[model samples]
Target: MTTSFLPQSPPAAEVRTAAGGHRTTVLIGTDTYPPDVNGAAYFTARLARGLVRRGVRVHVVCASPDGRPHTAERDGVVEHRLRSVPSLVHDSVRLALPVGVRGHLDRIMERLRPDTVHIQNHFLVGRMLAAAARARGVPVVATNHFMPENLFDYVHVPGPLRPHAARLAWRDLGAVLSRVDHVTTPTPAAARLLWEQGFARPVEPVSCGIDLARFRPVEGGDAQRGRIRARLGIPDRTTVVFVGRLDEEKRADELIRAVARTGADVQLVLAGHGAYRGRLEELAAAEGVADRVVFLGFVSHEDLPDVYRSADLFAIAGIAELQSIATLEAMASGLPVVAADAMALPHLVEEGGNGFLYRPGSARELAARVDEVVADGARRRAMGARSREMARAHRLEDSLARFERIYREVAAEGAAVPAGGFTAGR
Candidate 1:
């Protein structure tokens, strides 16, 4: 028997009362979760916690690092861990097909009889679980987290062949989404993309909220900033920080190129790591700006806020982010943002107001904006102040409440009404 860690459990009375006087069992399916550094994992963890706090019983079914079936309870939630393949990277893992595990999941579902099912990915496992839930009369709600374009970098196909493959992926995605009662997306842009790709269900915009209290701006003088910068070996000068995975999709190379064009005395700090780390380092050297660049791989969560506070501006060049949690965290830390005006970034970055935006893929345009933010101290401070205000409106409590409501609605709608029941408005 595997040891279970129950950090804290809600009172039985509270769980009974808020579950609408009925015990609610919500099954959340995902391929990835905690111990994997990604937006999807963070959002899943937060959403599950929120539901549990609201007197709902959540059962998370996800793939484990090792290929085996296991069970555990964490943070007032029950986890059903299945086996998977080990990832190429030391700190990562991937899900795999195992007959034993598949049978185990089926048996668990038979026993639980959950009221509602929620899936977060469009992979094979997600589809299987979603189909299983629907067959059992449980409402399934799937959230689209990955964009089809993300596959282009993995497979080497002709340009014309790429769009065809994307279409096929979307078709498969639509097949799974069509079976669900509703779909949720982190941004309106994402929801529209899903609708355009033939997901006919209601696509709700439920964003992943940030922790305001944990990311608030520092109030002291320059002492905190100076200490952090000095500790990180960042000189006492203007610093632009990029905090995310150092990969092609993140466009860290574009930031290096833009920083090379700027004449101002600014230091570029790249945090996080991935397969593209060496390439980014080489790009910095090729651009003749290696000396001004500092690459810190895999920054811990505890030190992230301090790193954001130490920077004069936060820069990101990616156009694929759904909500850009890092961007929101930067804004909450009182730093003006400079990001490409593509994807959902424009929704977060109000040009010439809270932050600045440049045309995507244009290093020159990004460079110009970076220069503008770095050159004016007063404008930077004003933009940072406005950014913090905007961040406040999207707090964790508010966003989680919206998700709880959606979960309850799906559960109630999925529940069967008695035969010859009184019709509404009769």
Candidate 2:
């Protein structure tokens, strides 16, 4: 069972309330946004849209897509893009300059008077947003989606300085998050880790929600299978689909070798991109499964449902996941999963039920588990039924409702920055 810290809001502070049951205005802050494509970006965009649909006005503060404030809008939600420079190391990720960030946020909050502020990270933009919002007497709710390892995956730092770097990162994170009324992570494992690292503030576990309607089994799923075969050029073959960034930590190369070890006539379809893709291709060629493996980088969101529906089974080789959104999506599509036994993945894949959890880094074990599922039609369908059942608890509406309640409680509690400003914890 998971544990959560009760929200500890500041006492005797005024909160911005909706005017006589009018639409509440919400300001969401994040470093990443849509068209960038990552777990954090996708969830933030959806959250904003969900709030907007429920008769709320949402304003998003995120990195500028083109270094200009053309400002993106979706279904009555508006994104205020700040100036950003694309990372030289990571072409897809951009860092918004912090210069005048707090000033701009202060002005925005003062003018808009949003009822609550939700931030998605502790980086430059998010950090500034929390402080500015608190200063303006708005309740703040922050969600952390990355560990230090995940951050360094995209931004390089010296190997020897990592320990000190981690400490520094934690200090910065602690200081900023301390100011927020509440904090959330995607899973219990993640919440526990933060608490162990001296993040004494309130922490809650919220799943990264998936669109259950689109991802679930469609028309007995037979109609989707034929098209998948034609799209990937693999007719009458067992297919294991892995959808996520092809980064080193994701261990896509290891999955390929594991499939090769199985010695089954199975095809591996990878749907996502990262800096490590070249290395993955090289590894595939060396493993002699190059012909069977397909790298379909950056699959469109519209086509993602089909990709999941067409697969016979899904696999997650990565161990660093707090909660695998891809695993949930596959489960929703009525596909059994084979995930690495590490981090929070074990919480989702019940042994001998929906799928098996192989020891992390054990390619042979992973292959054996995956082959077991794909080898039998009856067994596969039974496991897939369990997967669908598991996915129901994580429906998008459930997560959205949880967040909605959090926002309302914090706002009603009237939490605000103390008179002397936030005090940093030791």
In model 1, the Cα lDDT at residue 179 comes to 70
For candidate 2, write residues 25-64 as lDDT tens digits: 7899998876665778877877877666555678999989
Clashing pairs in 2: none
Model 1 residue runs over 4 Å out of place are 1-23, 87-91, 415-426
- List the global CA lDDT of all models: 0.76, 0.79
Writing each residue's lDDT as its tens digit, candidate 1 over 1-426 gives 111111124444444336347756789888777655567776888778767876778998888756676888887789888877765432453674555655666777899998888898867567778867866777877788887665465444568887778777777777677677777888898887776666655689877787777787767747778888887667777889988776567888889999898878888998777767899888898999999898877566567777788898899998888888889888888889999888888878888998789988888888889899878889888999999998887786788678767777988787332122111221
Q: Give lDDT: candidate 1, residue 192.
A: 76
Q: List the residue pairs that clash in candidate 1.
A: 68-83
Give the residue spans of candidate 2 off by over 4 A: 1-20, 158-160, 221-224, 231-235, 417-426
Q: Assess every candidate by TM-score.
A: 0.89, 0.90
User: On a 0 to 1 TM-score scale, where does candidate 1 land against the true structure?
Assistant: 0.89
